[model samples]
Target: MVKINILYASTEGNTTSFVTKLTDIAAENGDIVVARCIGEETDYANETAPFVAIVPTYLTGGTGTGPEVTEIFTNALGDYIAFGRNRQYLKGVIGSGNRNFNVQFNLTATRYAQRFNVPMLFAYELRGSKFDAEKAYHIIKPLFGE
Candidate 1:
């Protein structure tokens, strides 16, 4: 089975719940899934599995971002990339945001994907729906050669 590492950051628990469902789905698909919340753990550079990040957008006007979450990932992965470590691991991202934010919606995922040169697999509004979880699974499964 392929191993998948998920790093998540949640402000009000919505992103956490959404990631939990996605983790269950990934597990059901026979992939080994390991998850860590940003503040709870610091090091992501040692992860040997393909990486996935689930984060929520905290939009400050038009500048959409997840400051702490992004910083954690950036610090770890930036060093890894600079040192040419874990270069073969595939990376994926998912973002949660309020639709009322308009153009800023899901911008966190977008920015992260660009930074890492990975794909933004899915972007969900608020807590996300059942359909969004399923779609995320489908997108992620194939990356594991499932």
Candidate 2:
């Protein structure tokens, strides 16, 4: 069985939605996809099993006190990726941008993705509540090569 981890950190449910879509797609294809919040710890027997992280970008600069959501997952996955033997098991989604909805954020998420070397995908341009879920799916799907 092909197992995949879909981890996410979302404050306003935006990033959560994205991760949901990712998990759903992977599940539909017969992959054992696991989705969880950043704070939650999961047990995966396979160190090189595929993993994906989804983190949200906030307009404000404060990172939530707890492990910054994405960081927790990245740090966990990074260990496996750093070994240079698990390239196929790493992927990620960055929640940022949404111009039509007037949502703006610092985009620290992109940097996090870079740090882990996981493919990054934005939800939408900076805007206010005008997030297009379809667009987000399209953007994130490529990272999974869906």
Candidate 3:
């Protein structure tokens, strides 16, 4: 059984919803030993199993304020990802983005991915800002290679 840990840091629950579908897909295949969803607990120390971190990006328009998950995200990176010191782990990071706000978030995701050198996947919103659970699952289903 392949254990999959899905960690999320969501501002408006957009990413949270996306991660849920990913977990569902993992379960449907019956290959997942365990699929857990966590929020504000990205710290690697808190994670006992090999896991994947999925960060969702929300769209910000003029006079729009974005959600904040930096503290949780950075803490996890410091513990699990070897950015400065020398360390390595099997981890995957996937980021989801809104229509127009994706560019900035994509850059942020890439920076983090490059720093950690972990497998990274970025999913951009095809049409809308709010992600449909079922649609999201189908969109990312093929990416799991399952």
| Tens-digit per-residue lDDT, 26-135, candidate 3 | 56766442434343454334444455555554333432333343323334433444433323433656665655652454443454566678766555452223345444
Off by over 4 Å in 1: 28-30, 40-45, 61-90
lDDT of 2 at 94: 51
Which is the leading candidate under lDDT? 1
TM-score, predicted candidate 1 vs. hidden true structure: 0.75
* lDDT tens digits, residue span 57-139, model 2: 54343344233423323344344344455445666655554443242342545655676676665544433232454454445
For model 3, the stretches where C-alpha displacement exceeds 4 angstroms are 33-48, 58-87, 126-146
Model 1 Cα shift for residue 139 (angstroms): 0.5
TM-score to native of every candidate shown: 0.75, 0.50, 0.57
Question: Comparing candidate 2 with candidate 3, which one achieves the higher TM-score?
Answer: 3
Lowest summed lDDT across 10 adjacent residues in model 3 is found at 63-72
Cα lDDT of model 1 by residue, 59-120, tens digit: 44334344533342234433443334553464777888888877678777787678778888
The 0-to-1 C-alpha lDDT of every candidate, in the order given, reads 0.69, 0.50, 0.48
Q: What's the lDDT for candidate 1?
A: 0.69
Cα lDDT, model 2, residue 97: 40
lDDT order of candidates, top first: 1, 2, 3
What global local distance difference test value does model 2 have? 0.50
